[model samples]
Target: METKHIIITGTSRGIGFELALQFANAGHKVLAISRKTPQALLGHSNISCLSIDLSIEEDLEKVTQFIEHTWKKVDVLIHNAGVLLLKPFDQISAKEFEDIYKVNVFAVANLTRCCIPYLQKGSHVVTVSSMGGIQGSMKFAGLAAYSSSKGAVITLSELLAEEYKEKGVAFNVLALGAVQTEMLQEAFPGYQAPISAKEMADYIFNFALTGNKYYNGKVLQVSSTTP
Candidate 1:
Protein backbone atom coordinates (compact mmCIF):
# COMPACT_ATOMS: atom_id res chain seq x y z
CA MET A 1 0.00 0.00 0.00
CA GLU A 2 1.22 3.49 -0.77
CA THR A 3 1.91 5.58 2.31
CA LYS A 4 -0.59 8.44 2.27
CA HIS A 5 -0.24 11.65 4.24
CA ILE A 6 -3.50 12.42 6.05
CA ILE A 7 -4.56 15.50 8.02
CA ILE A 8 -7.33 15.07 10.60
CA THR A 9 -8.78 17.74 12.89
CA GLY A 10 -10.43 17.41 16.33
CA THR A 11 -8.16 14.67 17.61
CA SER A 12 -8.34 15.41 21.31
CA ARG A 13 -10.73 12.49 21.89
CA GLY A 14 -13.60 10.39 20.59
CA ILE A 15 -13.81 9.73 16.84
CA GLY A 16 -10.96 12.04 15.97
CA PHE A 17 -8.54 10.22 18.28
CA GLU A 18 -9.59 6.84 16.92
CA LEU A 19 -9.13 8.00 13.33
CA ALA A 20 -5.64 9.27 14.08
CA LEU A 21 -4.63 6.01 15.80
CA GLN A 22 -6.06 3.79 13.07
CA PHE A 23 -4.27 5.62 10.29
CA ALA A 24 -0.97 5.73 12.16
CA ASN A 25 -1.18 2.04 13.09
CA ALA A 26 -1.79 1.23 9.43
CA GLY A 27 1.56 2.78 8.51
CA HIS A 28 0.11 5.97 7.07
CA LYS A 29 1.46 9.33 8.21
CA VAL A 30 -1.10 11.35 10.15
CA LEU A 31 -1.05 14.95 11.33
CA ALA A 32 -3.62 15.22 14.07
CA ILE A 33 -4.84 18.71 14.96
CA SER A 34 -6.85 19.72 18.00
CA ARG A 35 -6.96 22.45 20.59
CA LYS A 36 -5.35 20.05 23.05
CA THR A 37 -3.11 17.17 21.99
CA PRO A 38 -4.10 13.71 23.08
CA GLN A 39 -1.52 12.13 25.43
CA ALA A 40 -2.10 8.61 24.10
CA LEU A 41 -1.21 9.74 20.59
CA LEU A 42 2.19 10.96 21.72
CA GLY A 43 5.01 8.45 21.00
CA HIS A 44 3.26 7.08 17.95
CA SER A 45 5.98 6.90 15.31
CA ASN A 46 3.54 7.59 12.46
CA ILE A 47 1.52 10.35 14.08
CA SER A 48 2.45 14.02 14.55
CA CYS A 49 0.13 16.23 16.55
CA LEU A 50 -0.57 19.98 16.57
CA SER A 51 -2.43 21.91 19.22
CA ILE A 52 -4.34 24.90 17.87
CA ASP A 53 -7.80 26.36 17.92
CA LEU A 54 -9.13 25.90 14.42
CA SER A 55 -11.18 29.07 14.70
CA ILE A 56 -8.01 31.10 15.08
CA GLU A 57 -6.75 32.20 11.66
CA GLU A 58 -3.12 32.73 12.64
CA ASP A 59 -2.97 29.38 14.39
CA LEU A 60 -3.73 27.66 11.05
CA GLU A 61 -0.43 28.77 9.56
CA LYS A 62 1.33 26.30 11.78
CA VAL A 63 -0.41 23.54 9.86
CA THR A 64 0.52 24.97 6.47
CA GLN A 65 4.12 25.38 7.56
CA PHE A 66 4.19 21.82 8.89
CA ILE A 67 3.06 20.49 5.53
CA GLU A 68 5.45 22.69 3.54
CA HIS A 69 8.46 21.79 5.68
CA THR A 70 7.51 18.16 6.24
CA TRP A 71 4.73 16.25 4.44
CA LYS A 72 4.86 18.46 1.31
CA LYS A 73 1.65 16.84 0.14
CA VAL A 74 -1.69 15.71 1.52
CA ASP A 75 -3.55 12.70 0.23
CA VAL A 76 -6.56 13.18 2.49
CA LEU A 77 -7.94 16.02 4.57
CA ILE A 78 -10.69 15.33 7.09
CA HIS A 79 -12.55 18.17 8.75
CA ASN A 80 -13.70 16.34 11.85
CA ALA A 81 -13.72 19.13 14.38
CA GLY A 82 -17.01 20.78 15.28
CA VAL A 83 -18.68 22.71 18.06
CA LEU A 84 -22.22 22.06 19.25
CA LEU A 85 -24.63 24.68 20.60
CA LEU A 86 -27.82 23.28 22.05
CA LYS A 87 -30.19 26.05 22.93
CA PRO A 88 -33.63 27.15 21.89
CA PHE A 89 -33.53 29.61 18.99
CA ASP A 90 -35.04 32.35 21.10
CA GLN A 91 -32.59 31.85 23.95
CA ILE A 92 -29.48 31.57 21.80
CA SER A 93 -27.27 34.63 21.63
CA ALA A 94 -25.65 35.80 18.41
CA LYS A 95 -22.19 35.34 19.87
CA GLU A 96 -22.92 31.77 20.90
CA PHE A 97 -24.28 30.95 17.45
CA GLU A 98 -21.35 32.60 15.74
CA ASP A 99 -18.96 30.62 17.90
CA ILE A 100 -20.40 27.36 16.64
CA TYR A 101 -20.21 28.49 13.00
CA LYS A 102 -16.68 29.70 13.44
CA VAL A 103 -15.43 26.30 14.52
CA ASN A 104 -17.76 24.07 12.55
CA VAL A 105 -18.02 25.99 9.28
CA PHE A 106 -15.45 28.74 8.90
CA ALA A 107 -12.57 26.68 10.18
CA VAL A 108 -13.21 23.94 7.67
CA ALA A 109 -13.10 26.44 4.84
CA ASN A 110 -9.93 28.08 6.13
CA LEU A 111 -8.00 24.85 6.65
CA THR A 112 -9.01 23.50 3.26
CA ARG A 113 -7.87 26.71 1.60
CA CYS A 114 -4.48 26.41 3.29
CA CYS A 115 -4.12 22.80 2.11
CA ILE A 116 -5.38 23.32 -1.45
CA PRO A 117 -1.95 23.77 -2.97
CA TYR A 118 -0.71 20.54 -1.42
CA LEU A 119 -3.70 18.51 -2.57
CA GLN A 120 -3.21 16.75 -5.87
CA LYS A 121 -5.24 14.48 -8.07
CA GLY A 122 -6.87 11.59 -6.19
CA SER A 123 -6.84 13.63 -3.01
CA HIS A 124 -10.01 13.45 -0.94
CA VAL A 125 -11.53 16.03 1.40
CA VAL A 126 -14.20 14.78 3.77
CA THR A 127 -16.25 16.96 6.08
CA VAL A 128 -17.96 15.29 9.03
CA SER A 129 -21.56 16.44 9.46
CA SER A 130 -24.57 15.39 11.48
CA MET A 131 -27.74 13.65 10.35
CA GLY A 132 -29.69 16.63 11.53
CA GLY A 133 -27.95 18.66 8.86
CA ILE A 134 -29.67 16.81 6.07
CA GLN A 135 -32.78 18.36 4.58
CA GLY A 136 -36.04 16.75 5.80
CA SER A 137 -34.21 14.77 8.46
CA MET A 138 -35.74 14.66 11.91
CA LYS A 139 -35.18 18.14 13.29
CA PHE A 140 -33.99 18.84 16.80
CA ALA A 141 -35.21 22.02 18.46
CA GLY A 142 -32.02 22.73 20.39
CA LEU A 143 -29.53 22.08 17.58
CA ALA A 144 -30.48 25.03 15.40
CA ALA A 145 -26.99 26.49 15.39
CA TYR A 146 -25.12 23.22 15.33
CA SER A 147 -27.24 21.55 12.65
CA SER A 148 -27.29 24.66 10.47
CA SER A 149 -23.55 24.93 10.62
CA LYS A 150 -23.25 21.30 9.58
CA GLY A 151 -25.63 21.90 6.71
CA ALA A 152 -23.63 24.91 5.57
CA VAL A 153 -20.48 22.82 5.37
CA ILE A 154 -22.29 20.23 3.31
CA THR A 155 -23.08 22.83 0.69
CA LEU A 156 -19.62 24.25 0.95
CA SER A 157 -18.12 20.83 0.22
CA GLU A 158 -20.36 20.42 -2.78
CA LEU A 159 -19.27 23.75 -4.17
CA LEU A 160 -15.64 22.93 -3.50
CA ALA A 161 -16.01 19.64 -5.31
CA GLU A 162 -17.30 21.45 -8.34
CA GLU A 163 -14.60 24.11 -8.21
CA TYR A 164 -11.87 21.50 -7.92
CA LYS A 165 -13.40 18.84 -10.09
CA GLU A 166 -11.14 19.65 -13.02
CA LYS A 167 -8.18 19.58 -10.69
CA GLY A 168 -9.18 16.06 -9.56
CA VAL A 169 -9.47 16.85 -5.89
CA ALA A 170 -12.70 15.35 -4.51
CA PHE A 171 -14.88 16.81 -1.77
CA ASN A 172 -17.70 15.10 0.04
CA VAL A 173 -19.77 15.22 3.22
CA LEU A 174 -20.82 12.46 5.61
CA ALA A 175 -24.03 13.20 7.48
CA LEU A 176 -23.73 10.90 10.44
CA GLY A 177 -26.30 9.72 12.93
CA ALA A 178 -25.99 8.90 16.59
CA VAL A 179 -22.47 7.92 17.55
CA GLN A 180 -21.53 7.45 21.20
CA THR A 181 -18.96 10.16 21.87
CA GLU A 182 -18.37 13.00 24.26
CA MET A 183 -20.08 15.36 21.85
CA LEU A 184 -23.04 13.08 21.51
CA GLN A 185 -23.36 12.79 25.26
CA GLU A 186 -23.33 16.56 25.50
CA ALA A 187 -26.04 16.89 22.88
CA PHE A 188 -28.23 14.23 24.37
CA PRO A 189 -27.45 13.43 27.94
CA GLY A 190 -28.07 9.84 29.13
CA TYR A 191 -28.97 8.72 25.64
CA GLN A 192 -27.25 5.62 24.28
CA ALA A 193 -26.16 5.68 20.65
CA PRO A 194 -26.29 2.54 18.57
CA ILE A 195 -22.70 3.02 17.40
CA SER A 196 -19.46 3.63 19.23
CA ALA A 197 -16.84 6.20 18.38
CA LYS A 198 -14.36 3.51 17.31
CA GLU A 199 -16.93 1.90 15.07
CA MET A 200 -17.78 5.18 13.39
CA ALA A 201 -14.14 6.07 13.01
CA ASP A 202 -13.46 2.74 11.32
CA TYR A 203 -16.22 3.39 8.83
CA ILE A 204 -14.95 6.91 8.14
CA PHE A 205 -11.42 5.58 7.81
CA ASN A 206 -12.41 3.31 4.94
CA PHE A 207 -14.55 5.96 3.32
CA ALA A 208 -11.93 8.67 3.49
CA LEU A 209 -9.41 6.41 1.79
CA THR A 210 -11.49 5.34 -1.22
CA GLY A 211 -14.95 6.87 -1.22
CA ASN A 212 -13.85 9.63 -3.57
CA LYS A 213 -13.41 7.07 -6.33
CA TYR A 214 -17.18 6.65 -6.48
CA TYR A 215 -18.38 9.89 -4.98
CA ASN A 216 -17.70 13.60 -5.20
CA GLY A 217 -19.85 16.48 -4.00
CA LYS A 218 -22.15 13.88 -2.47
CA VAL A 219 -23.62 13.76 1.00
CA LEU A 220 -24.00 10.27 2.40
CA GLN A 221 -26.56 9.76 5.12
CA VAL A 222 -24.79 7.57 7.64
CA SER A 223 -27.51 7.02 10.14
CA SER A 224 -29.87 4.33 11.37
CA THR A 225 -31.98 6.46 13.65
CA THR A 226 -34.23 9.51 13.37
CA PRO A 227 -32.43 11.79 15.78
Candidate 2:
Protein backbone atom coordinates (compact mmCIF):
# COMPACT_ATOMS: atom_id res chain seq x y z
CA MET A 1 0.00 0.00 0.00
CA GLU A 2 1.22 3.46 -0.83
CA THR A 3 1.75 5.92 1.96
CA LYS A 4 -1.05 8.46 1.71
CA HIS A 5 -1.35 12.11 2.66
CA ILE A 6 -4.66 12.21 4.49
CA ILE A 7 -6.62 15.18 5.76
CA ILE A 8 -9.21 14.53 8.47
CA THR A 9 -11.52 16.95 10.26
CA GLY A 10 -12.99 16.79 13.79
CA THR A 11 -9.88 15.13 15.17
CA SER A 12 -10.30 16.74 18.58
CA ARG A 13 -12.08 13.59 19.78
CA GLY A 14 -14.21 10.55 19.08
CA ILE A 15 -14.19 8.77 15.70
CA GLY A 16 -12.11 11.51 14.16
CA PHE A 17 -9.35 11.00 16.71
CA GLU A 18 -9.48 7.29 16.18
CA LEU A 19 -9.17 7.75 12.41
CA ALA A 20 -6.16 10.01 12.82
CA LEU A 21 -4.45 7.55 15.13
CA GLN A 22 -5.13 4.68 12.79
CA PHE A 23 -3.78 6.54 9.79
CA ALA A 24 -0.70 7.70 11.66
CA ASN A 25 -0.10 4.23 12.98
CA ALA A 26 -0.30 2.92 9.43
CA GLY A 27 2.55 5.30 8.56
CA HIS A 28 0.35 7.70 6.60
CA LYS A 29 0.91 11.43 6.93
CA VAL A 30 -2.23 12.77 8.58
CA LEU A 31 -3.26 16.40 8.79
CA ALA A 32 -5.85 16.68 11.53
CA ILE A 33 -8.15 19.66 12.03
CA SER A 34 -10.50 20.56 14.83
CA ARG A 35 -11.75 23.55 16.74
CA LYS A 36 -8.95 22.90 19.21
CA THR A 37 -5.94 20.62 18.95
CA PRO A 38 -6.42 17.49 21.00
CA GLN A 39 -3.57 16.60 23.35
CA ALA A 40 -3.37 13.08 22.03
CA LEU A 41 -2.28 14.40 18.63
CA LEU A 42 0.15 16.99 19.91
CA GLY A 43 3.84 16.12 19.58
CA HIS A 44 3.09 13.34 17.12
CA SER A 45 5.49 13.61 14.24
CA ASN A 46 3.26 11.82 11.78
CA ILE A 47 0.23 13.90 12.68
CA SER A 48 0.03 17.65 12.14
CA CYS A 49 -2.88 18.98 14.19
CA LEU A 50 -4.41 22.25 13.13
CA SER A 51 -6.69 24.24 15.38
CA ILE A 52 -9.35 25.47 13.00
CA ASP A 53 -12.99 26.11 13.79
CA LEU A 54 -14.91 24.83 10.79
CA SER A 55 -17.97 26.78 11.87
CA ILE A 56 -16.10 30.00 11.15
CA GLU A 57 -15.22 30.88 7.57
CA GLU A 58 -12.08 32.76 8.56
CA ASP A 59 -10.48 29.71 10.13
CA LEU A 60 -10.31 27.90 6.79
CA GLU A 61 -7.23 29.88 5.85
CA LYS A 62 -5.05 27.66 8.03
CA VAL A 63 -6.27 24.58 6.21
CA THR A 64 -5.81 26.17 2.83
CA GLN A 65 -2.24 27.12 3.65
CA PHE A 66 -1.45 23.65 4.90
CA ILE A 67 -2.75 22.00 1.76
CA GLU A 68 -0.85 24.55 -0.31
CA HIS A 69 2.56 24.17 1.37
CA THR A 70 2.69 20.95 3.35
CA TRP A 71 1.72 18.17 0.96
CA LYS A 72 0.83 20.13 -2.17
CA LYS A 73 -1.36 17.13 -2.83
CA VAL A 74 -3.71 14.93 -0.85
CA ASP A 75 -4.66 11.29 -1.20
CA VAL A 76 -7.71 11.37 0.97
CA LEU A 77 -9.89 14.08 2.45
CA ILE A 78 -12.41 12.97 5.08
CA HIS A 79 -15.04 15.39 6.27
CA ASN A 80 -15.74 13.73 9.58
CA ALA A 81 -16.48 16.81 11.62
CA GLY A 82 -20.13 17.27 12.55
CA VAL A 83 -22.38 18.97 15.06
CA LEU A 84 -25.50 17.40 16.52
CA LEU A 85 -28.55 19.42 17.48
CA LEU A 86 -31.00 17.24 19.36
CA LYS A 87 -34.17 19.23 19.85
CA PRO A 88 -37.75 19.14 18.75
CA PHE A 89 -38.22 20.48 15.22
CA ASP A 90 -40.49 23.20 16.49
CA GLN A 91 -37.92 24.26 19.08
CA ILE A 92 -34.92 24.22 16.71
CA SER A 93 -34.04 27.83 16.01
CA ALA A 94 -32.75 29.05 12.66
CA LYS A 95 -29.38 29.82 14.23
CA GLU A 96 -29.13 26.25 15.50
CA PHE A 97 -29.85 24.91 12.01
CA GLU A 98 -27.27 27.21 10.50
CA ASP A 99 -24.65 26.11 12.99
CA ILE A 100 -25.20 22.46 12.26
CA TYR A 101 -25.24 23.06 8.50
CA LYS A 102 -22.05 25.02 8.69
CA VAL A 103 -20.07 22.16 10.13
CA ASN A 104 -21.86 19.18 8.65
CA VAL A 105 -22.69 20.32 5.12
CA PHE A 106 -21.15 23.65 4.17
CA ALA A 107 -17.79 22.89 5.73
CA VAL A 108 -17.52 19.68 3.76
CA ALA A 109 -18.56 21.40 0.56
CA ASN A 110 -16.26 24.38 0.93
CA LEU A 111 -13.24 22.42 2.02
CA THR A 112 -13.66 19.87 -0.75
CA ARG A 113 -14.00 22.61 -3.33
CA CYS A 114 -10.91 24.41 -2.12
CA CYS A 115 -8.89 21.23 -2.02
CA ILE A 116 -9.56 20.37 -5.66
CA PRO A 117 -6.24 21.77 -6.73
CA TYR A 118 -4.52 19.50 -4.24
CA LEU A 119 -6.43 16.45 -5.34
CA GLN A 120 -4.79 14.33 -7.96
CA LYS A 121 -6.31 11.52 -9.96
CA GLY A 122 -7.05 8.49 -7.76
CA SER A 123 -7.66 10.70 -4.77
CA HIS A 124 -10.82 10.16 -2.69
CA VAL A 125 -13.16 12.25 -0.55
CA VAL A 126 -15.23 10.60 2.15
CA THR A 127 -17.92 12.27 4.18
CA VAL A 128 -18.98 10.74 7.47
CA SER A 129 -22.72 11.00 7.65
CA SER A 130 -25.17 9.38 10.05
CA MET A 131 -28.00 6.90 9.72
CA GLY A 132 -30.19 9.82 10.66
CA GLY A 133 -29.32 11.48 7.36
CA ILE A 134 -30.71 8.81 5.07
CA GLN A 135 -34.37 7.83 5.25
CA GLY A 136 -35.67 4.29 5.98
CA SER A 137 -33.55 3.98 9.09
CA MET A 138 -34.67 4.02 12.67
CA LYS A 139 -36.29 7.40 13.09
CA PHE A 140 -35.18 8.93 16.31
CA ALA A 141 -36.72 12.12 17.61
CA GLY A 142 -34.99 15.44 18.24
CA LEU A 143 -32.55 15.47 15.31
CA ALA A 144 -34.09 17.90 12.89
CA ALA A 145 -31.07 20.10 12.40
CA TYR A 146 -28.46 17.41 12.61
CA SER A 147 -30.25 14.97 10.35
CA SER A 148 -31.12 17.52 7.73
CA SER A 149 -27.57 18.83 7.63
CA LYS A 150 -26.19 15.36 7.14
CA GLY A 151 -28.76 14.70 4.46
CA ALA A 152 -27.44 17.68 2.55
CA VAL A 153 -23.93 16.37 2.96
CA ILE A 154 -24.88 13.18 1.14
CA THR A 155 -26.39 15.08 -1.74
CA LEU A 156 -23.41 17.36 -2.01
CA SER A 157 -20.98 14.47 -2.13
CA GLU A 158 -22.95 12.74 -4.87
CA LEU A 159 -22.86 15.86 -6.97
CA LEU A 160 -19.15 16.26 -6.33
CA ALA A 161 -18.53 12.70 -7.46
CA GLU A 162 -20.11 13.39 -10.84
CA GLU A 163 -18.43 16.76 -11.19
CA TYR A 164 -15.02 15.23 -10.56
CA LYS A 165 -15.44 11.82 -12.08
CA GLU A 166 -13.33 12.67 -15.10
CA LYS A 167 -10.58 13.92 -12.84
CA GLY A 168 -10.56 10.58 -11.01
CA VAL A 169 -11.49 12.13 -7.69
CA ALA A 170 -14.10 9.90 -6.07
CA PHE A 171 -16.61 10.98 -3.44
CA ASN A 172 -18.54 8.73 -1.09
CA VAL A 173 -20.69 9.05 1.99
CA LEU A 174 -20.96 6.61 4.89
CA ALA A 175 -24.19 6.62 6.81
CA LEU A 176 -22.90 5.02 9.95
CA GLY A 177 -25.05 3.62 12.74
CA ALA A 178 -24.72 4.06 16.47
CA VAL A 179 -21.18 3.86 17.74
CA GLN A 180 -19.67 4.25 21.19
CA THR A 181 -18.46 7.80 20.66
CA GLU A 182 -18.89 11.08 22.44
CA MET A 183 -21.47 12.17 19.84
CA LEU A 184 -23.57 9.09 20.41
CA GLN A 185 -23.23 9.35 24.16
CA GLU A 186 -24.34 12.95 24.13
CA ALA A 187 -27.24 12.26 21.80
CA PHE A 188 -28.50 9.30 23.78
CA PRO A 189 -27.09 9.33 27.26
CA GLY A 190 -26.60 5.91 28.86
CA TYR A 191 -27.04 4.12 25.58
CA GLN A 192 -24.53 1.36 24.82
CA ALA A 193 -23.36 0.49 21.32
CA PRO A 194 -21.62 -2.71 20.37
CA ILE A 195 -19.48 -0.85 17.87
CA SER A 196 -16.60 1.22 19.14
CA ALA A 197 -15.05 4.30 17.66
CA LYS A 198 -11.89 2.40 16.84
CA GLU A 199 -13.87 -0.22 14.93
CA MET A 200 -15.58 2.38 12.82
CA ALA A 201 -12.32 4.21 12.32
CA ASP A 202 -10.67 1.08 11.00
CA TYR A 203 -13.45 0.50 8.52
CA ILE A 204 -13.38 4.10 7.36
CA PHE A 205 -9.62 4.16 7.02
CA ASN A 206 -9.62 1.08 4.83
CA PHE A 207 -12.40 2.47 2.70
CA ALA A 208 -10.71 5.82 2.31
CA LEU A 209 -7.58 4.06 1.22
CA THR A 210 -8.90 1.79 -1.56
CA GLY A 211 -12.70 1.56 -1.71
CA ASN A 212 -12.95 4.21 -4.38
CA LYS A 213 -12.37 1.70 -7.12
CA TYR A 214 -15.95 0.48 -6.94
CA TYR A 215 -17.72 2.77 -4.49
CA ASN A 216 -17.68 6.23 -5.96
CA GLY A 217 -20.86 8.27 -5.70
CA LYS A 218 -22.39 5.73 -3.34
CA VAL A 219 -23.97 6.10 0.09
CA LEU A 220 -23.23 3.04 2.16
CA GLN A 221 -25.30 2.56 5.29
CA VAL A 222 -23.32 0.85 8.02
CA SER A 223 -25.42 -0.49 10.86
CA SER A 224 -25.18 -3.49 13.16
CA THR A 225 -28.41 -5.38 13.23
CA THR A 226 -27.09 -7.28 16.23
CA PRO A 227 -30.18 -7.08 18.34
The best candidate in terms of TM-score: 1
Write model 2 residue lDDT over 92-186, tens digit each, in one string. 88888888888998888888877899999999999999888886677778988888888888999999899999999999999988889998899
Model 2: per-residue Cα lDDT at residue 187: 78
What shift in Å separates residue 210 of candidate 1 from its native position after superposition? 0.6
* lDDT to native, each model: 0.96, 0.89
With a 3 Å backbone cut-off (N, CA, C), the pairs that clash in candidate 1 are: none
